[model samples]
Target: MMREILSFCALTALLLTGCTMAPPYSRPEAPIPQDWPSGPAYKDAFSKPDAALAVEVQWRKFFNDHRLQTVIAMALKNNRDLRVAALNVEKARALYRVQRAELFPTLETGISAKKERVKISGTQGMVNLEEYSINLGISSWEIDFFGRIRSLKKRALEEYLASEQGRRSAEILLISEVANAYLTLAADRENLKLARSTLETQQAAYNLIRRRFEVGFAPELDLRQVQTRVDTARVDVARYTELTAQDENALHLLAGSPIPADLLPRELSLVKPLPDVSPGTSSEVLLRRPDILQAEHVLKAANANIGAARAAFFPRISLTSAIGTASGDLSGLFETGSFVWSYAPRIVLPIFDARTRPALEATQVARKIALAQYERSIQIAFRETADALASRGTLGDRMAAQQSLVDATARTYQLSNARYEKGIDIYLNVLDAQRSLYAAQQGLIAIRLAKLVNQVRLYEVLGGGGDASTSPEGL
Candidate 1:
């Protein structure tokens, strides 16, 4: 009979698993254009659309710099923010396990002993009594007939998935930040070198002018003019030196440790540009981005919560059962005649509750909010990718133009110096030409850095070359 009772309970539980109050879930339509933007700005950028997913590209393959690869690898292992994100995933997994366990009964076993003394008012004596029992039982375990427990479990599972995606988002952001910081450091180093070289050349010119003035051959105005140029170059050298130091500090912070000197880029020329990537034709690709995936998982969790809230309005059933032995004496506790058992079933019907209706309404509203958030994530991703593509298209042309300007200015500065020495032009002409050459050279460096940084931004906004199924370790 006990075996039959257990089998019946198992069957009932199995049937209950099929009954869920949660509404069916369907992904909302993406609120962006079906195709990527096309115009003069995107003409060159959209030339090639690859079918390959971005997330599959390894960081090592994306960044050719060996030192940069080493820094990113170290950051992945030691960065505190990434570590916290990974821990959150583990925590969410544990919470989901706790919720999932509620679907099944929890069995407990124990032994108990008791002693009591009783006295009768009329009687001259008191009596002592003792009782003992042993039993195995399930406490008030909810039967989940309305799927409340199941819905809660579903919510927990979605939260866990969301946390996993959150971790991936952190990793992608970290990768981009590290790459940008490294590039900035390299650019600053190059600028400092240029500034120091310019200062040395200007100082040489200033020294010659001062000697010519002292010997009464050059005017005082020419001496002062050359001196001013030297001072300006010196200021630039100092400013760039400070910028390079700060860039190193920023890179170390992102790396989560002090960076080795050898790992730092020696000059801008040595830091290779990342290879070009094809941003796919459709904005649907943004749906696979980690942040977007995280938002969708959160929305699903909210949807599951609505099911749990709705289930609260229905009747709840719980069961408690025990099988044990009892007797007046401890020795007879397990005797055949001492065998005992019990079953208690409870039903909680909510005929009226001020909180239940409000709670359900709140969950519905929350689901709506989550849906908005999911859509917003999609919109933001679209804008970012579009902006990156636009910048990428124009940056190449701009860099090329700046390079040509540098070449023209350098030639002008050379001719002006020769003309001034031959007395064909005044000192002011040499000064103006030198200034233009310096400005043009600096502008070229700035444009080169922008072109490199834009590539990193494009890769980041396109979702870092991998999908949700890819492991975080792959970053």
Candidate 2:
């Protein structure tokens, strides 16, 4: 019956203590819009609002290039930013460990011996005396009460978790960047090839015109017109070649290796294709994005910090105790009588702190600021996901139109050349047709590049790419 009464008292203390402190935290009432902005919603833009996504079907799985996969894998392990992010995780964890240790008692042990000689005439006689003293014991230790120590430990652990999330966010970005860069290089190579092919066509036309002039069938003016077209096309090809080289170099730098001359294929002219991107609704993707997760962790840490700050306003209760033995001789240091120990539970009432109120207020304000930042992160993620979905739709339509235009221009240019050769149209008509085709070709490139680039942007918007080292999971 007595033991049952004791258990009831213990349960009562736990319940009462829990009630005295702030309750478990709930997130703020911030806006989480359920739907995306209207206009150009893809055929299957999203199935549901922002919900957490599975990690397996990441952006890397979107691309089929083996070369790209290899590069991304290597970057994760070697990228400098990823390495630094890893270090940050370690630092936060260590800080949490230190703070956690503070909640428990600290015990230290030491032994000391002292000798003193006293000589004085005031002692009634000249006396030389020697004394040896030794002691060993704990001096001070702290006991936590009033929730201060517990709150501090809790805050530290939350902060550690936040740092871990932050590292994952960095990893996500790194992989995304590498994917975009490689794809850009691929598209640029295709543009360069197109430029070369166009130049070759102009050169053939010029050769035919020059031969007609030699046979006295074409005038100098007609030959010069053909020459002008050839020159312009040649210049364009040269510029694109240089641009492609620069892109290659930049890609190598990001990849952290010497890009093989064949690092990428000579041409990447894919038959028009776009991925079937299912832009999951706002609610579905926003929370899964690494940055948003990191921000939430930060919010938790901030809430814990407020609890710690509030605990500081109350009296601190601590217990300090020590048990040790000391003796005048080295052999007796550990003996039973050569020991001294102390224990105390101190209550330090905060009667005043010229600096405490201001500090406490500052902490409270800082926590509020952190909360705002966390909410903003959520809002930003929501908008990005929506924007990407909308772009994919518009870009797809634009790409289809551009492909038709290129096909039509190519056929028209060929017809004009045939008519000029048969004397049905003037040479100037052929020149005009060729110029139109060249511009149409370039326009097609711009549209195609846009499609690929926007897809990359969409990936980033969803926090989908980058090497694992820089990704949230890798962190």
Candidate 3:
């Protein structure tokens, strides 16, 4: 009969505490326009209709280069920031479990014995008093009649989910960083190679001009001009050498380990092109972004906190119960007639505590703050995707113009050099053509790198070329 009564009470507690005081949650409308902004800058901003969304593509497939894929994998495994984010997810999960466990009673068991000396009423000597008992019980466990504990459990669960989204956001950011670093290093190496090739060409020209001057076939000014070009090329070669070394160091840092020589890119020209990505016509995709989702989860957690705070206003109920057996003699501790049971119920009414009202107000304010943050996250995401689209629209024209300029300059340099060799033109014309050609070539490389990197930026700002649902290695 006692066991039946205890089970009934436990079931009633569970049923009563199931409901929450939290307001219904409806996702806020996206603050951005329905469609991606269209203008001259967004002319070619989108991919084919059939192309997959950036978030649907996996990192391994988006980054097709074998070497780049290997580097990103290594970084994902070793990056400290990503590892910390994963650890935080684990920590939040543990905290949620702790909070959830409070919804049920905690049972404990114990055995105790006591002996003391006492004086008898009419005796001169003292007598020994002995007590022995064994028991099983619960201690001050909350029954949660007003749903305060349940609301807190909900808050903890939302926080755990938020932490998980944060980890996904970290993983996406790290992959893009590693890829960008790799691309930057490749571009710098290409620049170094160009400088070295130019140096070799100028050095050979200087030797030829020197021989001509010795034979009185070329003027002293011609020899000096050729020598100046050679010196300038030498300077560029040294500068780019330094730049390439620094680029490698940055790549190594992003990779979180020393990059193998075989995995390093020799030049941008040799690297494969990155695949194109599509941002669907709707701005709704931003809602699925990990950072945005993380913000929403945080807002939901804040909402849950408000529920907990509101539940504090009415009353708080807790149950402390014990069902056990006890006896004065050790042998009788578990005897038939020694069984006992007790239940103490407590209710705390917040009649005039100064803290309750303030706490509730604080939670309301926090929810507002979280709402603002959630809206701001959407705004920022929209801006990033817009900026990447703007660059994408104009980069193709820029690349074409730069390539044409390089071709024109190369032709001018070839014609001027031939004329100088035939004694029909002065050395200054060749000098000017040589400088123009070098500048145009360097500009072409810059434009090429910009175009490629813009593609990467587009991939990143559209929430990355990876799925958030799947966990990465180490996470």
CA lDDT, every model vs. true structure: 0.87, 0.68, 0.86
Of the candidates shown, which would achieve the greatest lDDT relative to the real structure? 1
TM-score of every candidate? 0.95, 0.85, 0.95
Q: Could you give candidate 2's per-residue lDDT for residues 230-322 as a string of tens digits?
A: 888888878888888888777677666766664464544552333444455446555656676677777776666666677778877655555
Clashes in model 1: which pairs? 54-465, 54-466, 55-465, 55-466, 56-465, 56-466
**What are the runs in model 1 whose C-alpha is more than 4 Å off?**
50-52, 119-124, 465-467, 470-475
| C-alpha root-mean-square deviation, each candidate | 2.6, 4.9, 2.5
lDDT tens digits by residue: candidate 3, 1-475 = 7697889777876665578888889999988899999999988776466778888888888899999999999989988888899999999888988898888778988788988999989899999888877768888886776678878988888888888888988888888888888888888888888888888988998999899899998889988988998999899889988888888888888788999999999888888898888899798988988889889989999998988999888877777778777777788887789888887888877788889899999999999999999999999999999998898888888888988999999999999989988989998999899899889988988887888888787777778754555332232
Q: Which stretches of candidate 2 lie over 4 Å from their true place?
A: 1-24, 40-56, 119-139, 270-277, 281-284, 465-475
lDDT of 2 at 290: 68
Residue 293, model 3: lDDT of 86
